[model samples]
Every structure is written in C-alpha cells, then in structure tokens.
Target: MSGESAKGQKSYTNALLRLENITKAFGNTKVLNGVSLTVGAGEFLTLLGSSGCGKTTTLRIIAGLERPDSGRVFLEERDITYSEPNKRDVNTVFQNYALFPHMNVESNVGYSLRIRSVNKVEIKQRVADALRLTRMDEYAKRMPTELSGGQMQRVAIARAIINRPKLLLLDEPLGALDLQLRRRMQIELKRLQRELGIAFIYITHDQEEALNMSDRIAVIRGGLLEQTGGAAEIYDAPRTSYVARFVGSANILRGVSALSSLLPNEIIAVRGENIVMEPYSEQSRGLKGVVTDKRFAGGMLRISARLNQSGAEVVSSRHGIDSPLTPGQSVSVSWDAASEIVVKDNDTGEVS
Candidate 1:
C-alpha cells in the first residue's frame, strides 16, 4: 500500500514551491520555529501533525492566508513571501467545502473564472473538464445543499482545480467525511493528482492517511519539522522517540539495558508488529514478562505485557484470532536485534 519508492523518484530539479527558514508567532506564543521545506513538481507531499502542531499554520502561509514573521516563500523560483493571495499561483481546498449554498455545482466550479470575466464559453468548458476529472460531471446540475458529503467535497475540489493552479493545498479536505467515504476519497484524490500532474501539499493529522497517500511526509511537532521522509523510511527508521510513537503505535522501552546500551536520556522504540511473544519459561531466550492484557482486533491479537525486570510495558501483535494469550500468563518478549530502534528522547538532545 506504500508508494514510497515510485513516488520518491519524482524529480525536485524543478521544484514547485520552497519555504526557507519560515517562522511565525502570535502575540507571545511562537507557532512556527524555523521551518523549511520543498515540494517538487507533481509530487504529493503531506504536512502531518496533531492539531495546533503548526501544520495548518504552515499550509496557510503557503496559501498566502497567513504571513510568516520571518523566512521566505518561493513558487517556481519567484519570491512570494509577501505576495497577495490572489497574485500567487496557488489554490486551496479546506476541510469545509465552502461551496455557496445558492449555487449549483456547475456555477460553483466556474465561479473563479466568472469573477475574473473569463469568456463564458471558456468557463463552461473548463468547468466541465474539472468536474469530469473529479468524477462529478454528472452532478453539475445538483445544488450544494442536495449533494452528499462526499459529493460536496468532490465539487469543492472541482472548484479549486478549475483554474488549474500549479500547486494545490488541501487542508484536511476529507476530515469531514465518514470513515469509509474518507478512505475512498483518499484514492480518488491521489488519482486526480497524478492525472493533473500538479504538486499537492496536503495537510493531515492522520498518520495512516499520510502513509497511504504521500510521496513524502513532513512530520511537524512543536512548531518545527521533526522528520521528513517517504512512508517506509519514516516508519522503519524514525529519528526520535516522538516520531516513532507519533507516526504509529510504538512501545517505548526505557532503561532496558539488556536490549542495548543507552544513556539516561535515551530509549528504545520497538513496533508492536515487530515484537515476538512466547510463553515464558526457564529456557526462554528473552526478557520475561507477564501478559497484562490481550484482545482480538479483527485479524490480529494485541497482547500487552509488563517486563518483570524493567517494568516496561511492551505490546505485540499476532495474526489470527486464535492467540491463547491471557492476562495473567507469563511470556517472553523478544525482537530481532535489527528491529530494535534506539531513538533520542525528544525532551533531551539527540543520543550520541
């Protein structure tokens, strides 16, 4: 399900957008601190982070909705750090569809061109093309109030793309949809991006969404970029404990000297799926632990255990519904040495 390798090959020699040492703050609280990133032409890059982590702020800055207190923004090699939103070659699709309730889909999609006094015939033709690209051509006659959430979202996308901007910024555009609809939209959005061959800077807090749709993900934390890489790279080799635990469910093992040597501020991060758990015995070859909890999660069994020596809680996953693990059972928790990822404690500096 990862497009890391194929998407990673997209060239950045002709970068579409670049932010240099961007910094922003409101009143006394700094929201963004020295962030810099680039979006290659036609590449799908996702800015991922939890709410208020500055992902949205970064997006707004790119879209010209917010200005960075410091740093420069360039699009197609032209500095646009202070350019008016209307002058920038950028378009945005927000979580809310923002479609006019009084307008039909066709009118909404053509509004930007119409407002600019584009020829009527050209607006009509372009609107149709945009709607068809989004697979919503047949619904052009429908009013915004009459469309389903997904349909409305499609219309919003059509509207945003009708002008054919070089870079499209989507600010959690699918967040309002139901789970099933959201998943379907993810695929549709990626397909549309490829077909358009335009760069997309998508914003989302959903790690799964980022992994499934992004060529590269920029993990943001505390107003700064924590790490940025393809889906597989970020997942398999996170640079810090915060990224390891934030991007997915990682069990942070602290003070576990048996696994590897660590400083007082360092820790180990082992993914649940990478751990191997077995019934504990005198001859067991790993840390002894007692199962503290077990649950059947559809196709896999999730087991949580507490290591007897370090009192560290570890989670492991086993395929199938037949796992016989019980809460009170003793088990040996071990993982391949290669699977042990020694990461820096985010609060402290990087581990040497």
Candidate 2:
C-alpha cells in the first residue's frame, strides 16, 4: 500500500483512549517528554522503539500503573489519569507470564472474576470461554509448572481478557519465547485481537513483530514519537534517518556526491532487497564495487560490497541458495530510482 492510504487508515471516529501531552520524569531523568497518542476502538496499535525509549512508560501510564507528571489520560472521553489501575477498564500482560504456581490454569484465568464475587456458574462459563478463545481449554487442569512457556503466555492472555476490558496493554509479551514459537504466537495474538474486537496497545522493540501484527505502528525515540503510520508506510517512506534504520535494514548513503538528485543535506536509504548486484562488465552503468562478504540467511543470500569510488559498504539480498560471487570479486551495484528513499538526518543524536 502507498504511504498516503496507510496514513489515512488511522483516522478513527470512535477513539477508545487518548493521551494528551503526557510527561513523566524520574528524578533527573525524564522518561516521557510530552508524548501524545490515540487508540481507536478495536484497533491494534503498537509502540515500537528500542530500550529506554519510553514505550513501556507510555504503556504503564495508560494502564494507570504510573501516573504522568503532566498531561491527561482519557478512556472513552472519561478522565482516568489519576485513577487507580484496578479502577480503570484496562488490563495488562507483562513479558513474564507471572502465573500463580499454586493455581491451575482454570483458577488462574478465573481469578479476577472470582475475586469480584461473581457466581460460580458465571465464573466457570467465563473461564471456559476465555480458555477456548486462547486455545488452552485442554490445559485448564494443568499447573503453570507443567505447561511450556507458550502455554503460560496463553494463560496470561486468557486471564487478562476474562474481564472483557475496553483496552489491553501488552508489554513485550512474546519476548520470552523462542524464535519459532514467537513467530507462531504472533499470528495467534493477531487472531485473538480480532476475535475479541478490543483495542490492543502492544509494546515491542522488534520491528518485525510490529510490522507483522500492528494495524498502525508508532515509532518512539528519545522519549518522543518519531513517526506513526502503517507498517508499509513506515518501511517505505521513513521521515528521518533514525526511523529508516530502526524500522528495517537500509543502505543509508550519506555524503555521496555521485547522486545529483539528492539535496546537500538529504541522505538516501535503499532496502537490501531493492538493490540489485551483478558481476562487473565493461558496459556496466552502475557503481563499481567488490564483494566484501556473503552469507546464507535461510531463504536468501546476503552479499556485502564496498564501492570503489566512495568506499561505502552496501548490502544486497537475493532469493537463492548460493551466490557465485566470492569475496574480492568485482561487482556493480544499482537500484531503480523509485526505490531510493531520501530522508533527513537526525539532528538530536539521541536515538540509540
């Protein structure tokens, strides 16, 4: 999809949550600096950023776990900034499963309803429904210790959704699982969000996770929102160098005088897969470079080349099992002009 249409998808008539000028500081360190955002009802929005970028703090503020030093939080137009966590209609699932070892899966999932004095019949029905939604009905009698990490995560999600909150906050909930399991859980989580039809505010530093599952992605940097758009919009047209590099792998070409199309201050970012590398020939029209390294990455081969004129390293990916190019082999690198992305350099230098 084009960036324009991707951005247009964020215009919502019914906003479920709104954060206005939220700011929080811990002693001399300011964690959130006037961060503002909105979550639409039944939308899946992800807070994407590296560690210490205030994404987690933003999630906590919305959950009422951490009150903002300044600004207001509104849930369905109701002011809930100073409300207690339990008082608000929001639930959180942390990275650690944090399941009760003494309780079985059914008891853990139904604990919230039980504490509220819900009748046994209603509680049991709700618990059963939650387990079935999370595909953990078969494991209801199992304890936390007997279940795997993925199962424990499912239980945590089930517990969070048992009360049917208006919004759910997930703080890197898939960080504990292995690669294969994490990928599978990503699909499962998206499906669960769709089935529940509730707003989900997910936190993650992994760009792939954000791109795969989020309806919209908000990229945070230096305690500020750098960019917010759909996955394709963020990947195709990043507004700044920090965002371009953070969202995906890009060949950032800076100070390349050879490209006359770019302004003096602007830099170019090309995706590895968009770049084409071929063996050098006398009739070659692209930049001459030598292959510096090559490696096999599952389904694709990644080749790194160093330009002879500018001495800048470039990486290109091709779909194949092996490449004939070897280290020190002469090659030419080129890409379509439409593939080049011109982005502004980050002046703050606060992005990690």
Choose the strongest candidate by TM-score.
Answer: 1
Candidate 1 residue-wise lDDT, 69-94, digit = tens? 99999998899999999999899998
Error of 1 at 187 (Å): 1.0
lDDT of each: 0.87, 0.87
Instruction: Flag regions of model 2 displaced more than 4 Å.
Output: 1-11, 258-260, 347-352
Lowest summed lDDT across 10 adjacent residues in model 2 is found at 1-10
TM value for model 2: 0.91
Q: Give the runs in model 1 whose Cα sits over 4 Å from its true position.
A: 1-9, 261-265, 347-352
Q: Write the per-residue lDDT of candidate 2 for residues 219-256, one digit (tens) a residue.
A: 99878999998889999899887888888778776545
- The lDDT, on a scale of 0 to 1, for candidate 2 is 0.87
The estimated TM-scores of all candidates read 0.92, 0.91
Clashing pairs in 2: none
Clashes of 2: 0
